[model samples]
Target chain A: MRHSGYQIWLLTLSLAAATLGAIVYATGMGHIAVPASEIIRVIAARVTSNPALLAGIDPVFPFVVFDVRLPRILTSTLVGGGLAMSGVIYQGILLNPLADPYTLGVSSGAAFGAALALLANLTMMGHFSVPLFAFGGAALTLLVVLYLSSFNGQISANTLILSGVIVGAILAAGISFLKYLADEQVAVIIFWLMGSFASRTWLDVTVVAMAVVFGLGLSFFYARDLNILSLGSRSADTLGVESGRVRWILLLGASLVTAVCVSVSGIIGFIGLIVPHLMRFLVGPDNRKLLPVSILAGALLLLVADTVTRAVLPVEVPIGVLTALIGGPFFCVIFRKRQRRVA
Target chain B: MSATSGFGLSGVSFDYGTTPALVDLDLCLPPGKFYGIVGPNGCGKTTFLDMLTGSKSPDRGSVTFMDRPVAEYRRRDLARLVALVPQDFGIDFAYTVQEVVLMGRHPYIGRFASPGAEDWRQVDAAMAAIGISHFKDRFVNELSGGEKQRVVVARALAQQTQFLLFDEATSSLDVQYTMQIFNVARNLVRGEGRTVIAVIHNLNLAAAYCDEIIFMQAGKVVACGPSDSVLESSMIKKVFGVESRVEVDDFSKTKQISFRYWS
Candidate 1:
């Protein structure tokens, strides 16, 4: 059946809003015994009932709900959206369905840079120095990969994937070297690698929000280019798309956002690789529609995953463990479905 | 037939690594003409077409359109005049026919502006002109090979370019679909004054449809001019190493070449 463009946008907006609300509510219910009413009460008191009611309430309840859970939930929404949008751009630009932020080696480079910053005392100078270093590292690594792949004149998908694999290995080696230098600092590196959202504050929220907003804004700006690139590079160029320019811009943009997210929350995996693919299955691959919807879906999935990681057991499970546990089977199911379709 | 020349290549040559692809290639295409290029594998037929559409730059000499070097033109400005139809059409998305056609209007769109009503009307007209309007809402990826070829041609037409290059565009199509595609190309040239340069492997089909033929051998133009001059039995044997019989059927008044042996 034919669907008007307006109808699709409207439907997407509703879905995103509904998912946003659900993430907020569910994350509020995690890591504590707060009922839904109490969660709402804590939020309402902070917003509407002013400082008087806030003063009378148990400081711990308000602190857990408003201070702790709220920032963590907001950070997850922004990071998830950023990662998914990055996946969409990478897949479209590279013209490969398997392309994602990590596949391009952005995450490994960021991990190396974060490790370097921690071991080198770079963050001792400024609060946001580590995240800044990570962002710069990701952008630089992507630029190098893009340059190397385009060396023979045309940037083929295979070339990008091959370069990404090579560069990722190199960055992983660098991270290991850093890990070995400071034996006691191994705990910090391991925690970062396993991925967590354990200690988020409003300051972390602000930095992540800034990066995600910039990333999504750039995604929308190049949404049309992404759609054209999906038609294949030759067709894209024939249709007046400067393929190289679009590719460089998108890779750097996505890498920057992903680096910031990883730097702040550690190396949360699977959301970038899975959320965009799931959104593509549901809504097809028009970047105009796929991008915004994926953003919402990613946030929703990550938030739910984050809540489960916290609430499923007395001890908090690392976010990476939960995502890996869910992502492997989920990817297998998608692969089997794809195989059936191809057959 | 028309006053304007769609493309002109002069003193052009190219090489891939150490092997020469095109050596001092020269060709001129007038507007509203159907030019078919035929050659064996690795004969540089596709390379010639790519140079004309600005996909690959010539190593020496120049390609010009309307007296301007092709490279000097802005990307969108070049697209406004010429469109290329590559042989392979693989898309990961499930965009409907209308949506794919609308993509051809990318050059006309402004930043953040959606396609206006007239733009969609043009998309509909292009689809209707190609007789695929019935599949407007059907997913493009689900179409048969022939249908996909037609849809892609329709997209090129929607670009509103004056010249189109078809790089072995019909290799994957069936017999009936191949002729249908040729008929569409014929209409675009005859009715709309659009110039078309197509790389075709089927000599008989080219004989029946093309106004001019250029035959390449090992990256050089061995023969070019009228279709009758280029499709001679001797040239076919020399370029393709196939013993072939050439005959002109009286009913169709077309030269047909049929290959019989490798020698």
Candidate 2:
């Protein structure tokens, strides 16, 4: 069904407001529980450049809100948004409902890069080295997959998916080998692989935020063309959509978003897969409407997951483990329902 | 047909890897008439339509629409002048029928702009013309095959191009809708002076609606002319390897062919 522009705008606005509310609420729930008012006050002060707003709060409150909670919260939110946006693009470009950001093997590539960095103990770039390497690995993997899939300047969905699976398997094996090489440090490597937002800093947040914003803008700009692309390449060509050019641009753009997100947060799965499907259920399949709503929903989902793991759980489970535990069952439900409907 | 005024192909050839789809050939199709291409499977009928729409460029020679090389026109410009209804449209997404039809305006709509009121009006008119206005709000995937084919036809109509190519577009529709759609195409050709080229599977239907007929066999045009001249029994036997009785239908005043197996 077609959603009116007003309805989509209203839905997007509500989602944006809810994400902000969740961020503020989540920021206040940690060990040293600051009130929501103080969280808002600290954020307000930071935004307004006014020290006067910090008068009555405990000195530790500002430090915890800014240095401890907010960075991790924002990073998880942006990463979630980025992954979800990527999922929408990947699914649309591939024209497969089952496709996700990881369908391109971007996460496996990023994981392989991070594992290599950890095994080698490279610290030349300090906290940025691993993420930088991971991004590089993802970029290279995307190039390889694109190269393998393209035949006479045309890339079919089946070939692209096949190439991704083959490349991803190779990378998965390479990561396993890196784990074997880590020996005593395998626990650290494993922990990173499990994924977390435990110690994310402002730098991580900024990187993800930039990538998500740019990616969202580009995706939205091409959302109409993406919708036409679902009609298949020949129809899209007849409708004047440069199917080859637009498909690859969207593939590269979405892979870039996935790369940055996975590099920052390790292998966070299912958000990219689930968020688009969930939002499509709500907003219909028009990518123009789906892109913004999916991004916000993704950000909200990841932030809530991070908050639950960080505060509500008795012990801190890795965020990735928590998401997979929840999302795997959730995905099965969606898949089963779709199968029943088709039957 | 005047070569300078209509779609003209000279020494055109295209191949699928090592296999030839369209051999080196020359053909000219004039505007403002319905032309039907009939051939057995894998006879390059669909490939010919692809060439006219510029979806596939010929490996040799030139294809021109209105005396301009089809390759020289921008993709959008070509789309503005020509539209196609493919045989198989495999869309599994849940876009409403109106939304699908509205996508025909993509070539005219700006990259960042939304579909204007004019675009919606064209969509509504096209849907109405194709008798699918009632199901405008229905999800395309939920519709029956015939309904979905109507929606696709409506989309091409909404494109409002002078040249329309149908690649076995009515294969899924029932006889009633198929005849209705052909009547609509005939009206587009007669009243609006548009050009239509349909790769038809049914010989009688093509003979009834098409102003001209082109028969292809083994990647070559075996016959091309009016239905009375080109659509004879021998040509049908030669192309399809079947014996047929060609008779003039008293009701429709058109040639009708009935096929028979070799005894």
Candidate 3:
């Protein structure tokens, strides 16, 4: 269970390299197949401000790589990383192996908001309206969960999760009601709820990138505290961690990351829950190592899934459905193996 | 009112909602001695330790260490001065013993910095002191109850605090492991000039090793003094509502108590 610093660094670097490789390889796969060399050359030409590298490639290839593929790929990658990072924080703070980014009902809140926006056909804010509403709903849900769980200024894990379940059930009902009201536009809401990465713009990538990067920094800064927190709040307090304050800060950070990612990507379910568990098995339970590894692994996993759907499959399936279909069975296997070991 | 060393509590009172856990308790504990807080169930022994460690702030009065209010110190600063080995220590993850022990150095290590050579040295010395260096790399969850408790004690030792508090830490251990932990605490006091206070349920074990004993009853201190003076038959009768015989051991010259019950 103990990995040396050298081993952790090597694993982290390897994962990072693999993620970069996956991004390039996935970008090249499409209806008009761009080669990996062409993808790399286009990216290098753009980054180095040297159009010379682009001279030999097809003129449409750079546009396809940058406008068509790169944005969707990067957005999915960042969203995956964000969700997985949030998952690590949530599990660490709540001290539950089953905890994920959506454990606090953030996804339910976001889905409800999106469904409402869709039913109302509110385009006042243009493309940003749905995501804005989704983010607002998610933030509000977290606040309610925190308020419900806190007693005498202390937030216990059990009560917090209980409140989340209670609130999430109510919001799920609300989302169904919105779907019922949609009637003719119901398919729009249903497709969105299923989630997809098609036609994702650069704006989505930028917003997700900011949130994920900031979240990574925040989670890493408190990674050691998160490790101590697994010892329970009392032990964490005795070790100089102001458990309540640190928990609040981390909860907010993780929730914000989750809210933004869900707003952009609809409801990608299992990346958050599964990636952290998988990375913990590899890097051990140290959050300092687990956080970085999970981020890279999540990005790689989701990018591969999205690529398989967008290019490998005869028809594109919604990214959310694909992840759940795959992740549900995978998670069950992990659970069964763990149960046997514990027994 | 302002003692320069050790812990000082004056008129300290705390309540969980309407039920008082500690009531109007005033006490001063000096340095470099092993003190035991002995009381029956529902008494305020654990709460008192909570106040001393600054984990709980007294609702009414004041709790101080080194002439300053404990509530005023930053958590990390206070952690450098006091460490507590709590009851019911359980880790949910598969953290290695060395990793768990090294967590005691959290206050000393920087936010962005990993444990340095000095931190590792202290951690190694602590594990070695508790004779757990052999399993330092073993997962803590895989260890037995006694082994886990030793690891916890090693963590506290790595903290290197002047004040060490144990809240019924040996309540779950076998007698041999209990003696092992108590021996470690005794060495910390007699050999290193550190203060060790433990809330002990086993009055016999408390009487055996503690330099002084404080008996609590109904959320108030009934008696506090040297072991021989405070651990008499009458004090036991008053605090525990039971009859007991107390005597000085022939070999160790320490007070020993035996309880009597209805046949």
Candidate 4:
């Protein structure tokens, strides 16, 4: 349903408030029974630098909230938002709502890069090598997919999807070959591919944060062009958008967002696709509004998903596995719906 | 308006690989006129529109707007000068009609800026001019073909350009909608002094609305003049390979045609 401005603003405000609540609740989770009240008190004390609020709090509680949980939860939220933001760009540029980083093969490219780094034990950039390589792989894949799909200057949706499928298939084979070469270290590769946020450090948060921020800056900068682009390339160009240049910039920026998120958290899938779908229903198709709401909604969805795996669930499931579990069925529903529309 | 006030094409040619779509075509389109490009299928009518609208540049010559090469104009600047109503108006995403029309303001608004009050005023005026203000809040994807076509026209109207190109914009419509669209284009030209160009398949509609007509055959213009003169029986037989009779409808004071397959 199309919402009026009042309704949209109300929904955005509520989502923002809900995200804050989720963060507090999520931080109090895992083995420790620290209530949300304690989470708030500890955070307040730390921020104000006053001993009065922390007078009676357990010393371990501050470390738990500030050190252990904050980084991981913050990282998950930012990564989730970043992925969803990228999804909006992909869907807008490709003019197909089903298009996402995963569907476009960007995530697989990042996965392949990380796997290659793992196999080679390439520590050239030390701990930074994996993400650097992942970024390289994703950037390279984007160029190849664009080149393969483009004819003259126009990139058709069908050609792009087909090229992505072919490139992704070949990359999947390359990843498997790397796994075989990994031999003893294949287990590590397998685990990373599954995706997780456990034991995430500030460095992980910092890197993903920087990439996502830069990405968001680009998204906001080109949000108007993206809105025009949804009308298709020829129309968009006539409507005053440099469709080719905008598509390349936005696609590369979004792919870089995906690359960083995947490098940090592995191939977490559906948050990108599902969050935008949900937000579109709430906010309609204008990217300027859809984008900000999608970012918040995506962060909340991923944070809740991670929380369930981290604390509420009896068995720890990989974040990637859980998103795919939910996202796969969701994808089928969307696919079936689109098929019905066509039929 | 000076010599540069309208569109000019000289030595224009385009090809799909070895097959030429437009060949060595030179034409002048004046301001404040309603012009129609007419030809049979694959006769470079659409290709000519594509070249004029800058969707495709001429391979061998220059297309100028106001005496300046269209290629030299920035995309946004060109968009401000000319707006196109494409043949297909179907969009996959659901944006409200108001939102779709508001996109015309893109050329005037900065990348970081939102549509301010003046922009909305133009949008409302355009929608009002097209008589679609009742469905302003409705999703564009849900509109009927005629209504959507009107919405697309409203978008171009909202662009507030000096020129409008209709690339078979009414080809999918019924006879009623086609007449309605032409009436709107004619009104724009007569009332607002806009340069309106349409690539039309229906000779009757073109004859009824267009002040001037260009007839193309085999990637070249065979005849061009006032519609009554340009769309005669001889031109019809030679260009479209059809036998036709042209008449000036007394009541409407416009050219009309009756056609049969060539014997």
Candidate 5:
């Protein structure tokens, strides 16, 4: 069984690699028509071996492949991977497979924060302030949820969910207040609300990259605790897990990862909820393998969605819309199958 | 505290906030004996198990395992010695039985070190021992209640600890499966010399399976001794408020409680 698992994982990796490469090459082909050869040349040049060839290549091809397409692709990859990983961690921690960034209200809180900052012209100083305040909002909302959920020290699952819903409602109300106060830029505010990866740069990608890497690192360390937690908190404690401490750390880490991803790319939904479920079906529920696999699958899925949105229509479709379109049906299929199994 | 104190509870007590769950409880179990705790619901059976397993710290005193205060042992070290098989588990993810069993090896795994061939061998052996080798690759969440309970026991076995605690591991199981599990536990104690402690509800089941029985009522131990001695008709009536006939099984020399009250 174990050997079969390794073989299956290797197979998954190969499939993911192929899918990722195809999406990149195909997506790079459209609009700009950067040839496959040029794409490869630029990639190879960027990596090593032949800088002179890369330098000799047309600056337009290099610019299109490296600067424009790569950042966008990388952004989708980071955000998708981060969201999926966060989803896995949250599900394990909560013992609820339905949990995701949105369930915890981190997305709504960050969106409200980003909207507040953007609409109020707080970003007038710089674009970085938007993400900074968005992260702050996410963290603050998490603190509020944690505080509200704790009943004399123990955090019940019901209380946690209820707290998140309440906090999310409050944040949404705040966003509406901002919307009402705004005289113009309602379009930009609405765009932010709907979600987008429209304007990504290397810096945005770097910020998301750091958050994902850091969150994934924290998750790996807590993965064992998470497995114990899945047994239920009392049992987890019997297994010598510091249940409360581990929970707080994981919840905070997952929320932080979600906030950073949303701040950079705007609330990309469904990837978090769907990617982990798909990965769990493929790999067993062990977080050790589930997390990394979900990250890869999520990146691939979101990249495909974004690529399709860009290619399917002349007008740019918000990446969020495309994800929900694909994710919603996929989610229904899973839910239906689960209902049948339960029945 | 001696080097061989397997488990010791000194004046331990617990409360569900204001309501007391356990009061002035004291227990000492040497490392290598099969022991049983028998009680009804709301009698603190689960709470006692929680205290013994470090899930709930005592409100007053402390529990010591292996000569070290349980609180002093790091979570990892505590797991190496004591393994718990909880009554029920909720699994959201569909981990295969083998994978679930392999997680018992978590404490032993070093950083960046994946489970090697030997670890898989141990897991396979555990699965085979529990008669669930056929279900090694099957999703755990998909298993029936009895099968899932066995898988949990197999996980505890894979932990390879000297001390194993079962919190009513077989309550939901059918008669044959329950007997099969207890037989396994008996073998672990008699054949392998491992210490086993179980919180069992059915007095007849405990009488048949346990070598020694501790009867609890109202957060305290009412009677404790060899199964026959602790499982008397008087003690059963006193603790459970139910009249019962106690008969000695000739083959096993165990006292079996037969309830007379229908209503």
Candidate 6:
């Protein structure tokens, strides 16, 4: 039976409210220790075009909220939402519950590209060069995977996945070799591979925002077709999905989403894999509902992870490790719970 | 054949890497009748069904429906006219029976549009017709093979198409499910003027239900006519290399075949 529209709307509204709350709550928890009220005041002062609200607040408040914390917070949140969105698309189009952005080796390809940039010292373009190379690597990997998997004008989902693993494995080796070439720069490459939100500026936020928003907009347009697709390609095609074309578009589209997310934040893990499954349990399997809700839930999850590591922990850990360390156990608990229910 | 009422394939052929799957095959399928195509394995029955449904195009000839080239219809447009029930009912997600059936209305619903009440009505009516209304709330994985097959049929029915194609849809089911699916199709053909073409492996099931049967061998049709006329022992022996006895079943008054020996 269909999920209640009223309930779905309420759930979505709650998530939206919670995500907004998460941003506010996380912004205040950093070392500078801006209170939640001051955090809101800083934002309110900026939006209302009144500098009076900033008076008597610690002079560091505006700088910390706007320059120090918010960008990192926003970037991580958007990247999380973006990764989850790509996860939803990949799982839906490939018709495999196991599929995610990394399932197709997109992250490996991006890391290899970023590694090459770091090794070669391609700093003339400055911060832009690494992400540019990363996008190139991801787009190229997608094309290669499609080429290797396609047969008689159709890309079999199994072949595509298998080919992704093969190509990803080779790229992983390439990244390792690049690490050796980097010598002293190996530290930077390793840090990048571990993934973080440190020192991210508004530029990174803008880049991820544009890509995720445009790609997700396109995905929502095809949301209904994606729903039909989980029934398998033949049924989807017979139901008027133009399954081949839709799959290709959504595959490349999801890859593009992954490309941007990796470019901004390096390879933050598990948000993609964990969010969709969790959201499916809550929202039912409808992509229309799942995609939007997963977007919010992913943002909240990643923001919390970023906050705990950046502030709550005594020593800063890579956000990627935090996600995996945190998300892995959560995923297992949920998976076990589901299995028991099934049994 | 009338200009606008039957499927016509003339001089059609297909090959899989130079191995011919179909060769210069010609067929005319009249609307409003239930037809079955049966043959030994590798006789291209599935391929023929594929071409009829526009899933595959012939290499050397054209297939037309209702006097229009099958290729000319847009995917969504053709979907309104033809729906296929694939043999595999495999789905990765654990959507409910209603969710699965509602997908049949995808062609009618626009992008960014959820299933409206009318679409839900069609889904409900289709499920009821297939006798699956009671299972509407159950997850599809919880269903029995026969119940799942009915859900599949309900999805096809919800497509609201003019032509229904079944590609070994009941191949994995037992005798009961086979008859159950066939009975559903039979009602569509008899009660409504809808056309159905099923590629079946069971000769007895084909003989019992199909109004007209086509017998194929080596990608070429060896017999095509009324079931009673074409399903005799001589054609069965010639095409299947099997000696068999064909007689009407007293219970259903339909042709029943009893196999003797393989040649």
Write candidate 3's Cα lDDT for A1-343 as tens digits. 4467899899999999999999998988889899998898999999999999998799999999999999999999999999899889888987767667566787778777766776787799987677667767877888898799889655665577689789989998888888888888888677877888877899989888988888988998889899999988888888999988999889878877887787777788878889998788778998988999999999999999999999999999999999889877876786576567657
- lDDT over C-alpha atoms for residue A169 of model 6: 91
Candidate 4, superposed: residue stretches over 4 Å from native: A37-56, A125-128, A143-163
Give the DockQ of candidate 2: 0.75
**lDDT (10s digit) by residue, model 1, range A206-249:** 99888888988888988998898888878888888887688778
Where does model 2 exceed 4 Å of error? A1-5, A117-136, A139-167, A338-343, B1-3
TM-score of chain B taken alone, every candidate: 0.92, 0.97, 0.95, 0.94, 0.94, 0.93
Question: Candidate 4, clashing residue pairs?
Answer: B4-B66
Q: For every model shown, what is its TM-score relative to the native structure?
A: 0.90, 0.93, 0.93, 0.93, 0.89, 0.92
lDDT of 2 by residue, B1-263 (tens): 25357799999999989989999879999898899999999999988998998889999989999989998988889888899999987776889999999999999999888789999999999999999999898898898888989999999999989999999999999999999899999999999989999999999999899889999987888789998788899888889989999999898788998888657
Estimate the TM-score for candidate 3.
0.93
Candidate 1's TM-score = 0.90
Report the C-alpha lDDT of model 5 over B100-218, residue by residue, as the tens digit: 88878777776568888877787888888788998787888888888889998888888888889999999778988788788988888898888899998887888887888888888
* Candidate 5: segments with Cα more than 4 A from true spot: A1-3, A19-30, A40-67, A119-129, A139-170, A339-343, B1-4
lDDT of 6 at A105: 78
lDDT of 6 by residue, A1-343 (tens): 3347788889889999999999998999877888999999999998898999998899988999999899999999999898899889887876655567675777778778877876787888877787778877887887787789878655565677688789989998898899888888788777778889988899999888988898789888889888888877777777887887888788777777787788777777668878998788778888889999999998888888888889999999999888878766865675466457446
Error of 6 at A278 (Å): 1.0
Off by over 4 Å in 6: A1-4, A118-129, A143-166, A327-343, B1-4, B261-263
Tell me candidate 4's TM-score on chain B: 0.94
Task: Assign candidate 1 its CAPRI class.
Answer: medium
Model 1 chain B lowest lDDT segment of ten = B1-10
lDDT of 4 by residue, A48-139 (tens): 99879987888899999988999999999999999999999999888877888887788999899988887888998987898888888998
* lDDT for each residue of candidate 6 in B1-263, tens digit (9 for 90 to 100): 35356799999999988889999998899898899998999999888988887878899999999888888878898889999988777665778999899889988987866678889999999998777888798988677766777788889999999899998888767777677778888988899878999998889889888999999998998889999799899998898888899999898788999997545
How big is the positional error of residue A266 in model 1, measured in Å on the Cα after superposition?
1.8
DockQ pick, better of 1 and 4? 4
| Model 1 C-alpha lDDT per residue in residues B121-160, reported as the tens digit of each score | 8898889877899988889878887788888888888888
